[model samples]
Target: MILITGTAGFIGFHLSQRLLRDGEEVVGLDVINDYYDINVKYSRLAEAGIDKNEIEYGKLVQSTTQPGYRFIKLDLTDRESLNQLFEAEKFATVVNLAAQAGVRYSLINPQAYIDSNIIGFTNILEACRHHVVKHLAYASSSSVYGLNEKMPLSTGDNVDHPISLYAASKKSNELMAHTYSHLFGLATTGLRFFTVYGPWGRPDMALFLFTEAILKGEPIKVFNHGNMVRDFTYVDDIVEGIKRVIENPPKGNPEWTGESPDPSTSKAPYKVYNIGNNDPVTLMDFILAIEEELGQKAEKNMMDLQPGDVPATYADVQDLMDDLGYKPETHIRHGIRNFLDWYREYYGYVTDQGADAGAITDQKKQ
Candidate 1:
């Protein structure tokens, strides 16, 4: 059996749907916290044939649409509950995608990071160790590459300087995974994802925010004064990479020595890979793509870089290609177009309403 955490999340929801469609038995878990919009989370679950009204917290309920899928509302930090579920389910593979995600939000609520990213991840590692799970795959982030002036960030690069608490938490996850892999013989793979965006995505992300703002006739906040670049990856591509990594757990490298250790792979059955489009697009170009898709130009309010925000991000996926024989192949225009299509259809945005985002923001503040 496969256990997927954060099933209500953007990536996790898509991944679970794909696995279920492939006729795999999947058990999904999530807390369904109200980080952004609870309705969106519920909508994703509804798409998966799991009705919100039918859900009972911490109880496994079978999906009405997909015969091979079940879902449980649970938090990772609840060690007792997690262990009990692990013991009962005997999951062969565990994919953890749950965490309090946000770079700037980490600055405001530092303890939330420790609770979810650190403590929760520790619980997952412990559960895997005890349950004898075959493989464990968890989401890391490109933000871990903070302060590195290198282009096309590679897993081989050392990530010592993290400008944000969120980045630090992700880096800590890697260290924790390595220790478990070394001592307990658990096979773990960490994926450092770069700017994942697509249909049914989080409202807090750039694509969703920008599309919403542009459609509403509001000025989109162009961070870094339109100088920032991102290796924007599509959700489907990331899910594909994750499936490949999960199916092929790494074997310990016999030649790996302490003399000159490779950061990507270890003597233990642990591996890390950069899962991204590898094509960096400037913020201006990204906004223009959104504008083109909506057939409306945004009122650009050029802004300086916010705290804990990086100016650029690029991924080196050579290792991913060599090992998995696949790389992310989605183009920016096509991806953005798809997102716009979905956004319009899902939100009933048939025509431009010219709703100003500035007005909405002001009202929220009031």
Candidate 2:
């Protein structure tokens, strides 16, 4: 069986659904915290046949829709309970995706990042160590490449200079995973994801926020005075890359040497790869894609780059393509359209005579 943490999250939800569709027995875990809108999280769970009303903390509930899937409402910081779940389930593979996400929020509440990303990740590592999991794949972020001006950020690039606490926490996860891989011989892979956006994406994300603000006739915040670039990856493509990584556990590289150590791989059974579109889109162009999809212009609120924000992020996914023989193929406009459609449907918005109109009823606004 496979254990997937953060199953209520965007990428995690999509991945769990995909794995279940592929006939894999899966156990999902999430704390269901009110990080954003709890309603959205519950809706995602409901879509997976795990009713929100049926969820009780620390209890496992079977999916009503997908026979092969089950879910548990558990926090990673609760090591005893996490260990107990691991012991009982005997999960062969584990994917750790639960973390305190958001760069800007990290600046305001650094403790949340430390609590969830650092301490919680340690608990996960401990559970995996004792449970004897075959392979462990976890989420890492491209934000770890902070202050890196290099174009097309590669896994081998030095990421020791993270600006945000959130990025530092993720970098800490990579280090912790490497320690486990080196000492316990636990096979672990770290995926450095770029800007992932699609259906059921986090409301705090740029795409969702932009869509919500645009549909509400509010000005969308365009940071860095619209001079930003990102390797906007689609959620489906991200999940596909993760699925391949989960199946192919890394073997320790014999060619690896301590003299000229590669940051992406180690002599231990540990590896890191950049999973992105390898195609950078400018901020203006990204907004233009949304405008084209919605057939309405966004009221721009151009501003300077906020603290803990990067001006640009471009990924070099050559290692992923070379090793896994896969690359993200979703176009930006297509991805935006998919997200916009889901947004409108979920929030009860509609196009009225060539213009979006309706009460979105966003819980986040409450």
**Which pairs in model 2 have colliding backbones?**
none
Candidate 2 lDDT over residue span 245-340, tens digit each: 999999999999999999889999999999999999999999999988888899999899998889999999998999999999899988998998
Cα shift from native, residue 232, model 2 (Å):
0.2
Candidate 1 local lDDT, 242-296, one digit each (tens) = 9999999988889889899898899999999999999999999898888887788
Worst 10 residues of 1 by lDDT: 357-366
Off by over 4 Å in 2: 352-366
Best by TM-score: 2
User: Candidates' lDDT values, in order?
Assistant: 0.91, 0.92
